[model samples]
Target: MENSKEQVIQLNLNLIVARGPPVPTIPVPVVAAPPTITVPAFRSEKFSVPEQFDGTRSKLLEFTTQLRMKLEVNHDRFRNDAAKVIYSVSHLEESALDQVVPLVNANLAAPFSSITAFVANLEALFGDPDPRGTALHQLVTLKQGKVDFATYYSQFLRIVANLDYNEKAKIDALTEGLSEDLKDAMTYRTDRPDTVEAYATMLMTIDN
Candidate 1:
């Protein structure tokens, strides 16, 4: 019996030796590096400024939109707003610069809040807020005497685009501008269009 008890004790000792000690694990935290951003360069030299400030507002806005898309920056902080404005208007006449330079110099200093704010400031100083005056005059004065329907249609649409005219006014302007023979023939049609778009479609059919 004593030999058997010593043998059991020996077995327990061997098991403990085989198992070894418990290890305490410590987790190390992982750190991520800041993101890097690169903006695409614009060839500002390729663009020329408009002859006058009358239609330059839209042109500049379009330019800024293209530039902002290319840069892919959320805010104007990457390129100084003032610098961007100057670059945009650099190709304009000296008279245009005379107006824009001082205003930009005075107003566009420091951290820009957003691209919208920057563009708004420049737009306000560049041209008339409403362009309906010139656009309406052009639409009213246009006539399709010798020009083809497609050419006349393109010019008609361009002028009417800037006007704040309703559907009725648009349809009327379109009908009135057609050649005398085409206008007469369209007026006699039983399916004379009620919508400006439908009228435009009919005109396109004539063009085709």
Candidate 2:
């Protein structure tokens, strides 16, 4: 019996020795870092200012005075004609004004080279508290270059269209409230002769 017990103990020791200590788990190696991404910088050229209009301030004042005189003399006819033209080329001008003015006014530093830029500036000026500001803004913005002269005429026709006896009265009152220089500046007609002639031709064709 003692020999049997001794044999059993030796069998247990042999089993433990054969099993051996637990093997340590090998850690997984990390891969190389991901590639870095870089973005290119954007560059833009500086804008150049164009030659200023000769006697622009004085001319603008004179124009405004002339416009006021015309408005006063042909008040009824102008209002009626303006209302009629609203739906024609004038509508396009107003639509453009609504788009371009706000953008230009917000960025005064931007160049006013293209019609698009001029329109934007006009839109911004329209929002001014002063009526003269609105008028001058419209005039200056439209006078950017010859490319937009046609557009300016169209817009002018639209403005005329919007004017009625009541609107004229309001404008008159607003003008009265402004400084004389501003009132005069608002009068200048920057519209192209060809455009005006075309507008006249178109007007003649329209039924009363």
Candidate 3:
């Protein structure tokens, strides 16, 4: 019995020795978040032309002439073909003015009501309501200068001067939006016939 008790004590000691100390757990490596991408605000620096040659007058003339032509040619068809007229006219008008005039005019005419609606739409879309919204509000108060044919001829000159003031910034925005190869291909000068022809063709192709 003494021999058996000694053997049991030995077995218990062996069992305790078999169990070792707990191993320390390694911590999980933390993953860093990706950096956010920000698009720079459009600045018009890259396509600078001399103050005298930003082509605002030419653009305005081309726009007005094309609009006048389309109006004359399509006036009869317009009553029956509202979609086609609207498409052609809107493209020309938008290209010329950058903003839709009829809609702008409508909004301006009903300033109190339309501005509230415009503001609500902007907020819903999460659009910035600073410069663009403010500029639009200013449109309501814009008055057409007195019209004379001679004055009209000089009107483009004044627009040219204003364009010159903003040329670098305007061109920068335009060039930034263009691909590098295509950026060189686009010209702002009024001297190029090919550019003029291409624009005219684009306008004419809508109807054809």
Candidate 4:
């Protein structure tokens, strides 16, 4: 029995010796790759108003719209931030900057609160208010003549610029200004456009 127990212990020792020593674990040094940053492709494409704008309120608004659209498209990273927008405006040329800076500076406390108020303030300075109503009445009565359609429409646009008419009123005023034959033809058409600009474009197209 003692011999059998000794044989069992020797067998266990042989098994452990046959299996090599446990592998020594070595800590691996892992290096993290640096993060990649994507820069805007149009980073160098600076934006500014094309020319020194006239003091016309509509023109000023139109210029601002164009500049805003460009910024939104090209500089999307900072487009929604008003501080970035104003910072971009600051870089405009002196002549172009003059057209907008004075107005912006005047309302420094809350510069962009209301577009309507901003435009109205500028309009008061540049746009003549036709309060007496004589000019608008005369303009509405004027009709197409020996003059081409472009000339007639130009006069129509000019007159409407001075008055504060809603879209419907503007369309009605334009329709009234048309010559008798043109007015009849437009009235008969089922597809006549509702907007003044569309109506004018149709007139110009037909006249041409």
List runs of model 4 lying over 4 Å from the truth.
1-50, 54-61, 68-79, 91-172, 175-202
**On a 0 to 1 TM-score scale, where does candidate 2 land against the true structure?**
0.20
Please give the distance, in angstroms, between residue 16's alpha carbon in candidate 2 and its true position after superposition: 5.0
Q: Score candidate 1 by TM-score against the native.
A: 0.52
Model 4: lDDT of residue 8: 100
Task: List model 2 lDDT by residue over 5-62, tens digit each.
Answer: 9999999999998899988899999999989888755433322322222223323333
What lDDT, from 0 to 1, does candidate 4 have?
0.64
List per-prediction Cα lDDT, in the order shown. 0.66, 0.41, 0.40, 0.64
- Model 1 residue 173 CA deviation in Å: 1.0
Q: Give lDDT tens digits, candidate 4, residues 6-118.
A: 99999999999889798889999999998988885656355554343455544554555565555655564563455444544554454545656775787654554443444
The predicted structure with the larger TM-score, 1 or 3, is 1
lDDT of 4 at 114: 47
Ten contiguous residues with the weakest lDDT in model 2 = 83-92
- Ranked candidates (lDDT, high to low): 1, 4, 2, 3
Q: Show model 1 residue runs off by greater than 4 Å.
A: 1-112
Off by over 4 Å in 2: 1-19, 49-117, 120-208
Q: How many residue pairs clash in each candidate?
A: 0, 14, 5, 0
Candidate that scores best on lDDT? 1
Q: After superposition, which runs of candidate 3 have C-alpha atoms over 4 Å from their true positions?
A: 1-55, 80-89, 92-98, 101-208
